[model samples]
Target: MSKLERNEILLLFDVDGTLTFPRTVIKPEFEEFFYSKVQPRATIGIVGGSDLEKMFEQLNGKKILEKFDFIFPENGLVQIEAGKEVGKQSIQEHLGEKTLQRFINYVLKYLSELELPIKRGTFLEFRNGMMNICPIGRQCTREERNMFAEYDNQHGVRKAMINALTREFADVDLTYSIGGQISFDVFPHGWDKTYCLRHIEKFHNFEEIHFFGDKTEPGGNDYEIFVDPRTIEHKVETPDDTRRILTELLGL
Candidate 1:
């Protein structure tokens, strides 16, 4: 970890488990800290796998977002500043729409073959810059989400799906990670969370950049960013853990 100096550090945060529980709103205490400590002391940015719409929901709408210096949505495929879109990169730009469509169809077909025991709704979610596929479907309730999540951990269902996808689409350039309770973030190679740094650097400078994320372990979405030399990464288990760490970092 690098020495902390006010105004000399950029703090990047992952949304799901770092700022809030997956698909949940940010806790009020942490939101207060963000407004009090982080926003005033450091360059604030959020790098997340979810789309801007989801980010807004997790953050409890646009009020919290306006406090940040920058925002990276869809794993940094889109960048925003002051509530306005600044820049964007699309997965279709790297892989043609036909190719992406093919991959989506292929995964859907694979899911059909599995015939998993769950009420399904919209197995494949296309986010323009990335895809999040949930075998149990995206429309699941919180309890149903938990049910599938438990089953997935026990069955290695996502791992099997990933293995099949790699073998069948060997010619395609793609990257994916198990995101949240029951979904996969599928995008072009190197479009992981680390992709945001290059864009954020063009606007701000920091001697030491720190990142907070839950999935910093191997084969996880935050792994690439955690391992990057440019960031001093901390693996947090939940949003409260993130808040606790931040409190220490800020010496509060």
Candidate 2:
């Protein structure tokens, strides 16, 4: 397809579990297929909860900026278009230091008191747009991450923590989202994946916006954009699922 023809549609994807496995690099075969076949048919973009650096580690490193037409890291709090950063937002700027500290302190206390199967360091990760709170810590090994995912599924640890946070910070205009296998994100209202649409709309008009993500259930980080009226949503379970849908939809 010609560039003009392809630009009429946007294929927006979530990083983890959509384009690649959770917190892992994209497979070489899939990467080659995506760049060689899939990317040629439409305008490609990525909206991920992780910071740009992490997105880089998983999706072709610094070259990612050149790969995707739109790169929305930190849920578009940090926006890059055509290899140039166009916009950025900061959680510290949105929520004053006093409130931010209070929230952090409260989360630390809650995590400290709560009992988990195991605990490691870096429980509270402050990002450009939000704070990622991991009860088992982000430094856990791959096996441990999978273990906690199973444990949280059966025990509802992350859900319960989100519930507690929702009640405690009810008046703070915040949104707590559960994503990936390990942690939930805390950000101001409207900072979810849908935030990227604002930037996309400002620059181009597309006939269709198709979003593919795994965590589209309620309170999942992808929920807002998945259900948003503007885009057609595809709920995928794995990178293979995403590739299948893309091939079927675009006839690749």
Note the Cα lDDT for every prediction shown: 0.84, 0.92
lDDT of 2 by residue, 12-36 (tens): 9998999999999999989998999
- The candidate that wins on TM-score is 2
C-alpha lDDT of candidate 1 relative to the true structure: 0.84
RMSD of each: 1.6, 1.7
Worst 10 residues of 2 by lDDT: 1-10
* Model 1, span 92-207: residue lDDT tens: 77788799779878987888888666866888877767888888888989999998889989998888898888898888988778878888888888888888888868877788
Q: Which pairs clash inside model 1?
A: none
Cα displacement (Å) at residue 21, model 1: 1.5
TM-score of each: 0.95, 0.97
Clash number for model 2? 0
- Once fitted onto the true fold, the runs of candidate 1 whose alpha carbons sit more than 4 angstroms away are 1-6
